[model samples]
Every structure is written in C-alpha cells, then in structure tokens.
Target: MHLPLDIDSVKGFLDPAEGRALHDAALAAAVRGPVLEIGAYCGKSAVYLGTACRTAGSVLYSVDHHRGSEENQPGWEYHDAELWDHAAGAMDTLPFLRATLRRAGLEETVIPIVGRSAAVARFWTTPLAMLFIDGGHTLEAALEDYRAWAPHVIRGGTLAIHDVFPDPADGGRPPFEVYTRALASDLFEEVLGVKSLRILKRL
Candidate 1:
C-alpha cells in the first residue's frame, strides 16, 4: 500500500517494524472481514491496518475514548503535554488521530468509534476478521477488554496484542498476562511475535 502520510512523524508508540507486521496481518485477514483495533491513540497503528484494509476493500473500526490512558495521564511516564486539552482539563488524542487518517487518505476505510472499549463491545455484533488489543495497561482494564472483545474474532482470524513483555522490568504485566490468557484458553495459537507485539490466530 502507498503511504501518503509520514508514519515516522506520527504521534504514537507503534514501532515501524511492528507496524509493518500489523499491516501484513491485516492485509491477509481483511479478506475474511473487517478489522477492529482497540486504542487507536494518534492513529499510527490505524495507518498500518487501515491501509491494508483499504487495499482489501475492507474496513477498519478504530475504538478509543480519546482520553489518555493510565500511563498517559499527568505525572506518569509516556505522558505528552501537547495532547492535554486545557479547556476540557483532560488529555485528548481524537484530533490527532483524525488528522492522521485524513493525511493517510484512509478516511473512508477507517471508521472511528469514540467511546470506552467495553461499552462499545457490548453493542458490536460484527464478526471481526482481525482484532488488535492495545488498550489500558492495568490488570482489570486488560481483563475487561479481553473478555468484552476477544470472543468476536472469527475463528481463524487474527488477534494482535501489543506491549507484551515477559520480563517484569521490561514493561507492565497486564498485556503479557492477557497474551498468556489468550493462549492458555486453547482458543488461540501464536503465529508471530514481533518485538512486544504478539499475533495469534483465533481457533
């Protein structure tokens, strides 16, 4: 897919290599159906998945609350003051994500759903071809997201989880735990692991 936007300049944490892997997975999975991702953030991952969806004539549903996550809030690491909304007295990344989609020429391919992941999942009935989990980092948050959304991935579909670190010092435990839970369920099988990203196939 042709990249109309400069992904490197994007305001998100998705690594370029990981983004490439995501794109590849979406390119294949989109043939089955639509792709959905939690935590669109500033749309770095959206650019990767959305473009692939566009090529497949499929859609990418991006779910996010726009508010900053736990680690992104004030005083915590990974916080960005520029994303702070003084008027709202909160962190907002919706504008930045919209800008990224527009510049990427993926406005039609990627649809943004502005709300909590669990809340949206309750109303989502579509069988997803691919589901990417990159939401909150707390154990409860991670568990809620997984329980609410993981079942919607079609059998043989792709499930991608980000920020997974086995080593305690590498990162938070929530994502790693989620990854392990998915595998332990006997419902998914690992097909690829790129950096901290784990790509599994829903059984």
Candidate 2:
C-alpha cells in the first residue's frame, strides 16, 4: 500500500529531534479509528502522524481555520510570510494542507476539515485514539481547544500540544499555563515533553 504523507517534507518542517519523538510515540501507540490533528499549518505534523495512521490502519482528521493567527504570522520565521497577507483577508489554510496531503498520497487517509474546534466537535462522537492540538496560542483559544478535544480522546490515548513555551517574540503566553490548569483536574497524566512540548495520556 502507498504510504500516507510525504516523509521528506515533514522532516523539512519539524525539528529533527521533536519529529522523531512524536513519530516514536505514534508508532508505540495502538491507534484505532480516527486521529485528530488540530491546526495543520503547512501539513508538517500531519506527515508524522499520518504515516503512523497509514501503518496502523487509522485515519487522520486535520482541523484548522488556517487563517494564520497574529502570533503565527508575525515573528514566527517558520511560516510562509505571504500566507499571512492572505490570511489577513479571508483565506484559509485547508486548501494548502489538502494539496500537501495529496502530494504525499495521503488524500485518502487524511481528511481536512475547515472550522473552529467547537464547530468540528459537534460532528465527531467516536472517541479519538490520538489528539494533536496546535491551534491558537491565546489562553482562551488554547483552553477551548483542550476542553473540546480532551473528552474525545479514548482512555490511554495521547494528547499532544505545540507552542507550550513562552516566547515573547511569538506571544507572551505559553500553552503551559493552560496545561498546568488542566493537569490539576486529574484528567490527564503528563507523559513526555512537558516543558516545551507536552504529551498527556488520559487517566
């Protein structure tokens, strides 16, 4: 069977270290049903998770508004600067992500959904085997994404988030604040990459 997602392009986007870590975790897990990836950006992370999904016989639902957050647009050197100009108007990132997934032969395994987390949550009732949240950076957005997705993660499933560290250049708030608050509730156990990146397993 053809592999889903382009390995080369994904490697080009993610840091070698972080990419390996995520790949390893995905490989180790027993992924079932559909995996959800919020905030696809340029489809870099999707390549990592999508590979695992293809191998494990699962689907990856990539969700993102793709309008480019103010923080993601400015100061973040990783993003395409031109996209922000378009995001400023009414452009969304779903199309670019779909194209990338198609190039990787992942169009079948990867489904791109355009909308906010709340709206998307309304349609999914099955428990997700993996949930990756790379949505907005603001406290409200981060919290909302977590609240909406956390319950959907099956017991022992993994929840991963990006932009967890404070970078004044990108934004004053780190997602840790939200993580810390959520962790206190005893719903998830921090598995790995807690400081900069966080991986939590449902308890």
Candidate 3:
C-alpha cells in the first residue's frame, strides 16, 4: 500500500482500487520469484507491483517498447499529445517510466526491458512469479502477448490482465478474449476481479 509515486501523477489507466489489488497479488506471487509486466506505459501499475515486489524482497521486470500502443497512437481515443515525440513522429513514454521509477525509489527493484513484447518474450527463459498483461488492445497484439508470456508464469503464480470487459459496451474485447482463452485452456483460474482488472492463478 504505501507507494512512493502518487498513482494519479503517473501516466496510464490503472484504477486505484485495482492498483491495490495488483500490489497484493504481486506481493503474494513474488514469494515464488520476480514479477514481469507487459505494457508498462508510464509505470502506474509498475509502481504498484514494484512497491510490493520491493517489500517482498523481490523485483519486477517491466516490459515495454515505449512506443505507444494502438490505442495510444495519434488520433486514437487514448492518445496523449504530451507523450508524442514530434521529432520521432511517434509516442515515446520511456522517459516518463524512468522518472516514475526513480521518483518512487524503485529503480533498483524494477528492471525495464524496452522492446516489442513478442521480441523480448521470445528469449525470456526465466519463470516468473507473476505476469501482468496490459499491452496492445488489438486482438492480434493481445493474443501474441498472452501466448508469448503466459508460459513463463510459474505454477500457482499470478497472471493479471487489464481492460477486460464482458459487456461489449464497456470497452474493447481483446483483453476479455485472452482472459477467457486462459480459462478455457485450463492453465489458469480467476482469483480476483476489480473493475476491469482480472487476476488469475496459474495452474
């Protein structure tokens, strides 16, 4: 619960109550190993997970390409002009992430892996205690992230997915699809649901 960075000040869409849930999940899961999260936009979720990992004497590996996701790009509903890199003609949030970790004194506890989610997952061999998926909202990107990283979750570990909406009117469907896929695969079982956040335990 005590996060160094003010949750609202960080760039991202994680709900405060859901953030607390993430912290609790990360704290429990980190007992098995370090936590890994995809789509660390500006470290809002990272701050929550990272603080818990730090408290548990573990670490969090935050994965992100820094370039905006499909919804975070220009002209998208989630786009933020402040995160746009005019010179690069792209959205870059890496700086904001670094600043967040630093301000939270979590630089040592959270390792940032800057690269496409799939590219990094391809070579990742470590079994993670927790895997937080909040990457691209497109089904292709969402499925890719799930398939790439879910296998790395240790048995009984935690797997958190954001932006899932059962009702179509609530939000996008990709995240919900992945959540259902995981349940269908029988590899994970839902343990908690807060707002649009779903936390499952690996089987």
Prediction 3 global C-alpha lDDT: 0.94
lDDT of 3 by residue, 88-137 (tens): 98999999999999999999999999999999988889999999999999
lDDT for 43 (candidate 2): 81
lDDT-superior candidate, 1 or 2:
1
lDDT of 2 by residue, 1-203 (tens): 23354456542235645656665566555355578888887787777777778788788888888776545555665556545444355435656677788788778877888788778887678788788877777778888888888889888788877766656565346477766765897978888883356788778
lDDT of each: 0.95, 0.71, 0.94
Checking candidate 2 for backbone clashes, the offending pairs are none
lDDT string, candidate 1, 120-166, tens digits? 99988999999999999999999999999999999999999999999
Ranking the candidates on lDDT from highest down gives: 1, 3, 2
For candidate 3, list the clashing residue pairs, or say none.
Answer: none
TM-score of 2: 0.83
Model 2: lDDT equals 0.71
Pairwise TM-score winner, candidates 2 and 3: 3
lDDT, residue 44, candidate 3: 94
